[model samples]
Target: MARQNTVHAAAAVLVVVPTYNERENLATLAPRILAQGEQFHLLVVDDDSPDGTGPLADELAAADPRVRVLHRASKGGLGPAYIAGLTTGMKRGFDYLVTMDADHSHDPADLPRLLAATHDARADVALGSRWTAGGSTRGWPLRRRVLSRGGSAYVRLVLGVDLRDATAGFKCIRASALAALEIDTIGSSGYAFNIELNYRATLRGFRIVEVPIVFTERITGASKMSGRIVAEALLRVPALRTTSLRPLADVRPLADARPT
Candidate 1:
């Protein structure tokens, strides 16, 4: 399916980019996002950064009618920034909202496939998955790939989420799915946020589909991954599973609950 046709089939897609110190990457990515041959808009929610990413986002917004910028007071966690962007997109009447890394790890070329999946498959949420068929990562070191695969595996095994890439940052969410999501109640704000959203969506019975995409290394800037971040994700896995299963507790067990 063509980008234009896919976009028209859904409500206008508003790409929500939460930026912090991404000035070097923003300029090139912003225009490319606009030129995707789709009726999508972009919202840049920038946490105040010494690197001037916020100002550059403002400049981009001024130049492009489809681009908008939101300035946060300080460098907040990723989860809060995304929540702000999603809220803004919904309030502005966008039917679809997408979030992705700003450092170019996510390929703009693959965006059309995600939108097409949302349209053609009637998916409430479309994920750009690296673990699924035809999906792969390029130029990543062995350690990085192992980390990603391990994180995804841990999430699936713990939360019972079958998504190939439970921690994928690249995702397209239908407006109805967003509305159905209890965004405010989500607690995790880092890599764990991706797992939280997918788990919650599954628990709510939303239809999710994955599209394979080649994830490339960011052309600029250093990675934000940290040991602390990884540790936090490990801690949050059980929390997500517990939260997800709590609601279903009222349903009587089909067979007596098996001991772990």
Candidate 2:
């Protein structure tokens, strides 16, 4: 899909933050996202968090017009939660959609910078990458860093994707580019979902740009990573190399609209 001719400053941008049990983080994260700029709106997708994050998201939505919450009946995994949020944001006429972590690992302060890069670079997708030049991580042990770097390398070698950080979660995607993707057909559910989406974007010939970012470890909340998630990524990467993807199409652009 070619870049839309509309001016990005006037575009409606929706930031989708997927949360499991992030009540403590949302309290601080929500306000920071809203403070980014007037063009930004926030969508918190909660998977029936046991820690009351869902109701807290409701409260935030009630308090601010720029904030909205999507409640899931059960924990369906990260990929489904994000897909639901992105579909809702697109249906409501957002020109751009951002996906990020709610645990503060992906900084809200970098939100504007990511959005700007997508527009300035005329990129269909802009990834906040830790492996790229000037990008780094904080509060991680050497083993964790090695695992992350190794995972990226493995995905690159198997999938032949050029992105430095193929599994990066922080991203700014043009709505048209997203609509072109067969999101309903994506099979990966864990962190591998990030890699699949990036790969699909590349397959469709979308211009993807990497924006250097400092990924911070979450201070609160338990980590969601598990052996099962790791196993899923390991099995899914090689499978994706041979999988045939659907062709891209130019979907209708969001009405030159803004949230009231």
Off by more than 4 A, model 1: 1-10, 244-260
Question: Candidate 1 clashing pairs?
Answer: none
Q: Each model's C-alpha lDDT?
A: 0.80, 0.85
The TM-score values for the models, in the order shown, are 0.91, 0.91
Instruction: Judge candidate 2 at residue 182 and give its lDDT.
Output: 74
> Can you write out model 1's per-residue Cα lDDT over 1-260, one digit (the tens) per residue?
36455546445889998888899999899888877755778899999978999889888888889999999998778888899999999898987889889999897776666776665566777888898877899999999899899989998788767777889889998888898897878888787788888788888877777778889998788777777778878999897656745331111111221222
Regions of model 2 farther than 4 Å from truth: 1-8, 245-260
Q: Global CA lDDT of candidate 1, please?
A: 0.80
Candidate 2 residues 1-260, lDDT tens each?
A: 01222334587899999999999999999998877777889999999999999999999999989999999999998888889999999899998999999899999888777776666556688889998878999999999999999999998898777767879989999999999887878898888889899889988877777888999999999999999999999999999977666443221111211122
